[model samples]
Target: MTTSTQIDTERTDILEMLAKHRHFLRLTVRDLTDEQAGLRTTVSELCLGGLIKHVAAVESNWAGFIVNGPEEAPDFSSMTEEQIAQWGDAFKMLPGETLAGVLAEYEQVAARTDELVRTLPDLSVSQPLPEAPWFEPGGRWTARRTLMHIMTETAQHSGHADIIRESLDGAKSMG
Candidate 1:
C-alpha cells in the first residue's frame, strides 16, 4: 500500500479501538445507580464518575495538543477552585454531571481529533507531547501514537471503573 493509504488505515484502526474502549467504559458504568457511581472503594481516589471525567478531559487535551502543539500547562486552572480541584483524577463529579453528558463531551473531542488527523499528512510528521509534568520530557509523538495513547489511557482507567463498579453492586465485565 502507498504511504497515504497506510496512514489512513492506521488512523481508522486507532479510532475504532478508541470507540470500543469508550463503549466498554460506558457499559461498565451505565447501569450503576447514582449512589453506586459515586461510591469510593479502597483503590485510588477514582470513582466511576471521576474516571469518566478524567478520560473526557484527557481527550480534549490530547486533541488540542495534537492540533495546536503542546500546551504550557493543562487548561483546568481557569476553572473555579472547586472545579480545578476536581480536574482529572479527583473523585468529585460536578453537580448535574450525567453519564450521557460525559459520553457526549468525549465523543465530540474524538470527532475533532479524527478530523484533524485526517487533514494532516502521513503520521511521520511529529508533534511535541502535551506539557503535563506527568509525561516524559522530550517525548514527541505522531498522530498515530497520540490516538494509541488515548486508547491505552482510557482502557486502563476503564478497568479501574469496572472494579469500583463491581465493588459497589457486584457488576461483572460483559465479555
Candidate 2:
C-alpha cells in the first residue's frame, strides 16, 4: 500500500473508534431528563451530564494543543471564592444548566475535534504537556498520541456512563 493510503487508513480507523465511543456515551444520556442526567447513580460523583461536559472540555483543550502549545494556566490568585468553587465543580452541571445545552456543546466540541484530525498538517506534530500534577513535567505528545488519549478517555467514560445509566433507569447503552 502507498504511504498516503496507509496514512488515510490509520486516520479513518482513529476517527471511527473515537466516534464509536462517543456514540456509546451519548446513548447513555438519551431520553434522560435534566434531573436524571445530573443524578449521581454510583458512589462516585460522576454523572451523565458531568461526564459529557468533562469529556468535551478535555477534547477541546487537547485539540487546541495540536495547533497551539500548552496554554497558560489559569491565574487562581485573582479568582473569587465563587469562581474557585465553580472551577472545582467544572465537571458537574450547575443550577440552570440543562442536559440539552451540555449535549449541544459536546457536539460542537466533537465537530471541532474531527476537523482538527482531518486537517492537521501531520499527526507527528508534538507539543509540551500542560502544567498539571497528573502530567509528567516537560512531557511532550504527538497529535496522534493526543487523539488516542481522547479516544481512551471517551471509551473509559462511556463504560462508566453506561453503568450510571443502567442504575438511573435500568437502561443500558448496549446489551
Tell me, by lDDT, which candidate is best: 2
Best by TM-score: 2
Off by over 4 Å in 2: 72-84
lDDT of 1 by residue, 37-154 (tens): 6667755677787778788777777767666677733654266877665464345455677666666776787788667666766666668775456778788987667767788888
The estimated TM-scores of all candidates read 0.81, 0.89
Off by over 4 Å in 1: 72-90, 130-134
lDDT of residue 41 for candidate 1: 74
Per-residue lDDT of model 2, residues 52-127, tens digit only: 9988878888888878878733445577999887766756877899999999999999999998888887889999
Worst 10 residues of 2 by lDDT: 70-79
Q: List the residue pairs that clash in candidate 1.
A: none
Local error of candidate 2 at 45, Å?
Answer: 1.8
| Overall lDDT per candidate, in order of appearance | 0.72, 0.87
